[model samples]
Target: MLENWKDKYIVFFDGECGVCNFWVQWVLERDKNDRFMFASLQSDFGQKFLNERGLESKVFNTLYLWKPGQYYYTKSRAVLQIANVLGGVYRLSAVGKLLPAFLSDQVYDLVSRNRMKLANQKCFLPDLEQKKKFIEV
Candidate 1:
């Protein structure tokens, strides 16, 4: 699973946040191209990623999209890139690119801060195939 992840886009998110988990499921549902892998921000692999990149490991509000040896995007950039990678109508997300990153991030932060209240803890049971997409779960 680890080796296979090297070729896919890795989405790192706040594992305990219902909203975060919801978004992960959203991506899973739309990923017809099998382009995404996921890791909870609390996982060891996620911690290592944060440490190596000099990011705060404990602050899980920030979402990270990593493409192994290629590149990584965070905050609004990550969200936009995920939509781009998902392709099709989601490509319209390009319009979001027009907003300044700072502005977009402010919106991300707002939602992140209130994410706990936005949704109750939701349990999503992934089927066998979907289970394989998780790293260090």
Candidate 2:
């Protein structure tokens, strides 16, 4: 069922994290081009992706953006690509690319380490149309 989204960018995130959900909602709202889909890292499909890539399947701290049969991005790179794809004002996010990858990843790691405490978990109910953009719950 999930394979249908292979042509689009898939955003894999921690289902239990509120901050992650917030960002997912943010992207959903800004995704005027319908270029992205989403799945929780805890889902079977997400685990398959992680396991196939030799990544830590159980740990969902890192954000991932996958372009099937092409390449995938994690951490800061994923965030930037997502913004770039969303376009419009988000295109400004391209400036982040000017920074060294190591430096940007450090910021991503710091946020990841404290993400749980940064926001409280809540049920995010999207409208029917927005809901369709999610896969595997």
Candidate 3:
């Protein structure tokens, strides 16, 4: 099914972060249009993405949303973009755009800094269809 990922949005996440995994699960459950695919920041695909963009690969502090050969969004911007892509009620996330990127990223940084302490949530198991959405997991 990896072949099906062409032209889909890619979400890059911290493989070891429980919070990140939880959100990945959240996105997977809500991706009604099948518009997203995922890869852990530690994977070869992810490393190449990061290296090509001159981003740090060793530290998985930021989330990234990428449209292959197009552009990528990071931090709170990524979250907002994800919400926007999800559409429907999630479009409510549009209000978040009113806040400046600096402010939004500050919030993102706070959560990122303490993500390990904050997320007690366990990532639910993915069904086979959902499982294929991951790239080199």
> Each candidate's lDDT (Cα)?
0.93, 0.91, 0.93
lDDT per residue for candidate 3 within 1-137, as digits (tens), equals 78876679999999889999999999999999999999999999999999999999899999999998788999999999999999999989989999999999999999999999999867667799998899993
Candidate 1, pairs of clashing residues? none
The sequence of per-residue lDDT tens digits that candidate 2 reaches over residues 1-137 is: 45569789999999899999999998998888889999999998899999999999877899999988989999999999999998888889999999988999999999999998987787788898987888884
Clashes of 3: 0
Give the Å shift of residue 98 in candidate 2: 1.0
Off by over 4 Å in 2: 1-3
Candidate 1 lDDT, tens digit per residue, 1-137?
67799999999999888898999999999999999999999999999999998999887989999999978999999999999999999999989999999999999999988999997786877889999999994
Residue-level lDDT for 57 in candidate 2:
87
1 against 2, candidate with superior lDDT: 1
Candidate 1, residue 36: Cα displacement in angstroms equals 0.4
Q: Which stretches of candidate 3 lie over 4 Å from their true place?
A: 121-123
Minimum summed lDDT over a 10-residue window in model 2 is located at 1-10
- RMSD vs true structure, all candidates: 1.0, 1.4, 1.2
Top candidate by TM-score: 1
Q: Report how far residue 43 has shifted in candidate 1, in Å.
A: 0.4
Q: What TM-score quantifies how close candidate 2 is to the native fold? A: 0.94
TM-score to native of every candidate shown: 0.97, 0.94, 0.95
